[model samples]
Target: MSDNRTWRARLIATSAPAAVIWIRVYVGVVFLTEGILKFTRPDTLGAGRFDKAGIPAPGFFAPVDGVFEIVCGALILAGLVTRLAVVPMIVDMVGALLITKLPIVWGDAPLFARESGFGDFLHEARLDFAQLCGSVFLLLVGAGSWSVDARLTATARSAASH
Candidate 1:
């Protein structure tokens, strides 16, 4: 009983404003779409692009990243374990900035991410930066009032009181 309460206590600890659902929705859709596009448009977004970026083992890593994005995006959309779900996405974005955007900023542009100047880097990196920030926000907040986490926490609290 005591152990269960401890677990429930941790679960019940999260509280967030409903506004965060907006961030979750945006982040989730973007990630999910990017993942699906990796499969549907492989030449542009998946292994081919990775190859152009000189990523090692492009075929293996791209698909793995796609699957990771899909699963994590779905979890974020459903507001389930959002804090945990966003961790992979955070890693994903950081890797993206390093692999794709940083090269552009350094003027050694990848095949697809070629840019004329630092301005191009800023423009191209905007989306990646936004998604990275959104993932961080979700990680900090742990979903919001309109989430599975909230419902589950509420349920846990009720059950505990009984």
Candidate 2:
């Protein structure tokens, strides 16, 4: 029984890295899609949404934000220095929470007012928080065992020894 338990524990420990990698990959994909959408439709997303959302420096920051998202998202998906890549995303989400979420939570009146009150702000805040949490998780946990970084590192180490 002890042997079986030990074997089961080892199996779970070994598989944990794979599970983390899978989660990172999927989350990266989500960010990538969002980045792509923003990149392609900067005017609608960049100008219109930010302007409506009351993001500061809307004119200049919007395009910059879109580009940053695209680049970071792509890097995250590729698992190329994933933790490094996510740093910018973390900052961006922080900016989002500050610029957009705070205003919604505490600001007077809805800027767009399709519906009044803080509901929209709360929703946006929730989304931003979720994304931030995901990115942070990737940052702390890393790209995981199955990622390109891991494979590349392993290959490089093998080559060096030879």
Candidate 3:
């Protein structure tokens, strides 16, 4: 029984890093996709969407936001400085939720489908919250074992020793 418990503990210890890597990859991919979509057609999500959402200074803010998303998304996908890369995304999501999903807008009463009810809005909010959670996790945990940054850091440390 002790041996079984020890083995289980070891397995969990080993697998924890793998889980972080998996989450990072998934989160990175999603962020990259969103960034690409935003970057490719800034106008699509530019002042237009912000205006509809009633965010102030959309014209000034949209381009900056687009660039941050694109660059950070690429960095996350490449696993280069993963934690640092995701910081901007975490901030961006928080800003978006605050500006776009405020009480009044949320009270718009059709969060998802145009004709959907309050339940739909809650569902959409939940999904958005999940996305925010994923982003925050990546920002905190980083790219893990599969990352180029890890390899580079290890290499640098080894070279320094010699």
Candidate 4:
């Protein structure tokens, strides 16, 4: 029994770093895809949606948000400056939840779902909340042992020890 527990622990330790990488990749892909879609389908998830949501300066903020998402997502995917990259994504998700999704939950139906019920509101906001939580996790935990940050830290340590 003890031997089985030891093996399980070893397996978990070995796989943990890979799990972080997977999380990074998953979140990065989501941000990247949404960013690209913002530009490619501007009338849907871009300025149009912003305008409908009553977000001020939708025309300017839409592209700006897209650029931030693309750049930050790319950085996170590369595991370079991932902590820094996720900051903006965290802020973005918070803004989305507050400015857009929360209102749906609170009774103000979104433009796309004015007829949707409270259950629909929860369903629609689920992804936003998940992304928010995921970004927070990445921000707190960083890129992990398999990342470029790990390599950089190792290099710095090696150099300092010399």
Best by lDDT: 1
For residue 33, what is the lDDT in candidate 2?
Answer: 71
Evaluate model 2: give its lDDT: 0.67
TM-score of 3: 0.73
List candidate 2 segments past 4 Å from native. 1-16, 107-122
Which should have the higher lDDT, number 1 or number 3? 1
- lDDT by residue for model 2 over 6-50, one digit each (tens)? 432222222127567665666677677776666577667776667
**How many collisions between residues are there in candidate 2?**
0
Q: Residue by residue across 1-162, what tens digits does model 4's lDDT show? A: 233344322212221264689888888888988998889988889999889889999899999999999998888887777777888999999898778877776578567456355686678778887878877877777777787777765665566568
**Cα misplacement distance, residue 21 of candidate 4 (Å):** 0.5
Query: Which ranges of candidate 4 are over 4 A from the true structure?
Result: 1-16, 115-118
Q: After aligning candidate 2 to the native by TM-score, how far in Å is the CA of 21 from where it should be?
A: 3.1
Q: Rank the candidates by lDDT, best first.
A: 1, 4, 2, 3
Q: What's the true lDDT of residue 12 in model 1?
A: 34
For 69-153, candidate 1 gives per-residue lDDT tens digits of 9999999999988888899999999999888887786788766344757888888889999999999988777889899889888
Q: Which residue pairs does candidate 1 place in steric collision? A: none
lDDT of 4: 0.77
TM-score of each: 0.91, 0.74, 0.73, 0.84
lDDT of 3 by residue, 58-105 (tens): 776777777777777777667677767777787877776666554434
